[model samples]
Target: MEEALPIRKIIHVDMDAFYASVEQLDNPELRGKAIAVGGSSKRGVVAAASYEARKFGVRSAMSSVLAKKMCPHLIFVKSNFDRYRELSQRIRNIFFEYTDLVEPLSLDEAYLDVTENKKGNPSATLIAQEIRQKIKEKTSLNASAGISTNKFIAKVASDINKPNGQKTVPPEAVLGFLENLEIKKFYGVGKVTKEKMYRHGIFTGKDLKAKPLEYLQEHFGKSGSYYYHVVRGIHNSAVKPTRTRKSLAAERTFSENISSEVYMLERLETIAEEVERRLTKNNVAGKTITLKIKYSDFTLQTRSKTLPFYISSKSLMLDAVKDLLFQEKMKNSVRLLGISLSNLNNEKKEQQPEPEESIDVQLKFDF
Candidate 1:
């Protein structure tokens, strides 16, 4: 007889409108009001939107101008990242109380593996509820969660209920849950992939499962395999406690397009300084420096150079950026400028993988 595979319990916790919620939490008057956390200037983008603002079609990454137009009464508040980070740390501390196997996706969201946890809890559903409640008690913020056997399903389930609620896809329900899920709601399917899936008559998990692996690979390339297994509830990704930072960058979008090389260099100097400060804070340096340019027509161009040694100083970074800047003439007036550093000295070395355990067991557990 074959040994039964261990069914790990995973939970994905996502704070509700984190940045905007922080703004609202700090200012009682801002509560229950439509607000956006970002500049309301012409070039400003919405960093986050309150649930009230979301009802008006204001969303993060939307232009502030459009956000205001969408909700004329929308109030714009400047972002307070320091406060956000402090509260995020508080929330993360709560997760550590239950399990050290926590993987933070961002300041507002994380994946927690609690199959065998400090609390000795076997019910991931109850664990998720406790975490959410503790986050509220500690930070006065609302959080939603998804509980499931894998990270992908847990992540998708987390969004089923918004603003302080959770959903658990138990082992027995995983297949049916995924089959009925909208193709767009699959964790990895973005607008482009959704359209491609639509073109291929893949409208939902069931539709995707209907195609053979070879057919999927022929059309979707490497990702076809990913779609194939995830829909069948075969995702086995572990919840890693620590994730390495791949790159560091800083950028600014101008209020007006500037074509002069001197002006561009002036802006690049400031951007490089910001990047250097971030690198110093992270205590890492990089060999590759890239200069990103966005033209008035919204076209982007990037130039990079790699050095023999890692350098994090603004002076060194600016020197490389200047070469890349002058290497090519301005295709058009520039609207945005950015500096990024890759090939960092702190990159993690690859480790050999262990074979994955099967997820083929019938899960009768409760969330």
Candidate 2:
């Protein structure tokens, strides 16, 4: 008889209404009211919404104006990223206590591989509960958790009982759980894919599994293979520990759209300076500089230029963006201007001292 694979235990944790909830927690007056966290201006986008606000059809990334029209009395609170990051670090510290195999997806969510934990605890479900309870105690915030044998199912399972709850899918029950899941609930199946699946009569996981592999691959291309295995409970993606910062960027949406070349040049110089500052603060330099422009109509475009050597100085970065901006005439009035530095090479990682709070840790376990 052949030996079986070791079943890995995974947990996905997501904070409820992170930014909006934090606002409410910090300010007692904001509680029990429909509130959103974002700029309140006409062009401002919603970053998050409280549960009460969500009931009013308000959502993140929607224009502030639309959100207001949806909820006439929606309270808008400006974002406090510094405060959010502090809480995020605290949450991450809690995760590190359980296992070093913690992968943070954002300031409010993470995936943890607790199969072999520092506490020597065997039940991932119990660990998740402990973590959620601790988060509530330490930060006065509620978090939901999903426990499963792999990251894919854990990510989906986390949503079963959202906003201060958890769900678990054991290895033996994984197939049964996936079978009844709706196609819309699948991670990669977005609005477009959901519509396509519905048109093809693939409304549920069972419907997806019934389709032939060749038919799926032909219809969905590379993603078809992904769906074919994931719906059948075959995802084996590991919980990666190391997350490299891929790029350093800074951008701003203007209060008003403008088209003048002279005005744009001035804005690019300012944005480039901010990018340079972030690159310097992060102790990274890059060979590629990308210029992003968002037109008034919301259409976006980017142009990148690669230098022969890495550059992080404000002047060098400004020169590159200036050229990219002036290289083409205005297509439409520009509403947003941004600069990003990519192909990052961190020289300080080896040649110089690390940042005061910098930590690079990895652990290995018996497989």
Per lDDT, the best of the predicted structures is: 1
Candidate 2 lDDT score at position 59: 94
Question: Model 1, 283: alpha-carbon shift in Å?
Answer: 4.0
Which sections of candidate 1 miss by over 4 Å?
1-4, 285-290, 299-331, 343-345, 348-358, 362-366
* Cα-lDDT of candidate 1: 0.90
lDDT of 1 by residue, 2-55 (tens): 777677899999999999999999999999999999999988899999999999
TM-score of 2: 0.82
Residue 281 accuracy (lDDT) in model 2: 87
Instruction: Candidate 2: give the clashing pairs.
Output: none
- 1-367: candidate 2 lDDT, tens digit per residue: 7454556789999999999999999999999999999988999899999999999899998899999999999999999999999999999999999999998999999999998899998889999999999999999999999998778899999999998999998766777788899999998999889999999899999999999989998999978878888887767667878666778998889998989978988887888888888887888899999999999988889999999999999899888888888888879999999999998895224222112211111012121
| Residue runs of model 2 more than 4 Å from their true location after superposition | 1-3, 196-202, 210-225, 283-290, 302-331, 343-367
Candidate 1: residue 336 lDDT (0-100): 97
